[model samples]
Target: MEIKTIGVVGAGKMGNGIALSAAMAGYQVVLQNRTAANLVKAKNSMENQLQKLVQKNVVTAEESAATMARVQMTSTFEKFDAVDFVIEVVAESLDLKTAMFIQLDTMCKKEAILVSSTSTFSITALAAVTQRPPQVAGMHFFIPPTKLVELTRGYYTSDETVNQAKAVAKQMDRVCVEVKKDSPGFIANRIYTPLFLEAFKAYEEGLASKEDIDLAMKSSYLPIGPFELADIIGLDVLKSSLEYYQSELGPSWSPPLSLKQLIRAGRLGKKVGKGWYDY
Candidate 1:
């Protein structure tokens, strides 16, 4: 199917970025969030990001305006009935995402493709909740949206569905890496989780301060340190991913006590102005 309209559920960081990218790619976009406040915040955030792009000469003012014009923000899932493609970018909780998949399955057109941006969950499990499992897949985009997108297939996902998703990713100018297995964390997080564990262990063991560890890793190869990246990705999100990994992978994937303490204190990273480092 030829996709022209894209629907994104949730208006947080990843959701807004994905919507903006689609709009910039010249697709009509529907960005949905449950709350009015979040919708407004997402609009403002997108506008600011576009302005930055304009200043950097990455996009002209006219181009930025056109991109914004292509996006329609809504608070109801009913608006998604006509969208040709829908991406769920809600919190990384199985129950929450499964409920969303069920709703999308009911609301979206039969030909519409449904995908999740979850970093560490089973695409097959989510597909099982919907009747249209063959149309379901995982399209994991990283925090801040690099050029890479991990496209994963569930047990029931069809080759046609994967091909369509890859086409959409290509339209958005992203490079696609197909993941054959329906494994937890897919590829990126499988590698990243171990790095994160070592970082946490080093800090917990008092080998170095978080700042120092971050500084040491910030080289020409890696633009951001693990702690800084964690802050931007949100500590709560990190903890949740770790918990999910621990359950599916092993005990080694468990979150450290210091991470839990920070979360318990309500420091959820840059979004909240506090995390491993205060903003």
Candidate 2:
């Protein structure tokens, strides 16, 4: 679709990180949030991430500032009307995302591609809300956007959007992988959920400590164990998604009781300073 500028909806961690990544890839970025405070935080977060890139010599200081400059944060969704693509990065709620897509469908140009970052919802339901099924698709990015190297394609996503999203992913230096369906959690989650659930089960059954399980994963060549990654992704977010998956997939994927209790106590991983490990 020849995307030049992208509209990122939501200023939470994923939205802000996606905007920063797109800006670093040399695209003009427009990011929006419903609240002014979140918008400000998103901007600051982008700046801080750019600074880290400069520190690591991945991006020059001038380049980092200019990349940071390319990103504009707004509280107005109306500004995204002209963007070539609208990636809905809002929280993981089907109703909220569908409503935003319906609004974007009315506000954006007909040709503007709509992509959802939803991890569990079916794209078919979201596409039904927009009346642009061919133009609507999934463009899931792994957490910690800087190192994103995998993406999932929805069942109805057009080959054109897949090609376009792959182009964008390449620009971000990601290793793009296609999924045949928008199945709950797509391929990565489909494969990893069992392992994660097993780990949680073991912990709940008092089979082993969290640290030992994590060490096993690291020793076995996995970058980090599920619990460790869940901590980074926020335990609350993971817990919520687990509940969603359990409802959608049944008992085998259900979140263990320990994880639920941990989230209720507010220990949501590295961002909150306590989870499976000390931050």
Please give the clash total of every predicted structure, in order: 0, 0
What lDDT does each candidate get? 0.93, 0.81
TM-score result, candidate 1: 0.95
Error of 2 at 231 (Å): 1.6
**lDDT (C-alpha) at residue 208 in model 2:** 90
What tens digits encode model 2's per-residue C-alpha lDDT throughout 58-114? 889999889978887788877777799888898887778889889998989888888
Q: Model 1, range 81-101, lDDT digits (tens) per residue?
A: 899999999998889999999
Ten residues in a row with the worst lDDT in model 2?
144-153
TM value for model 2: 0.91
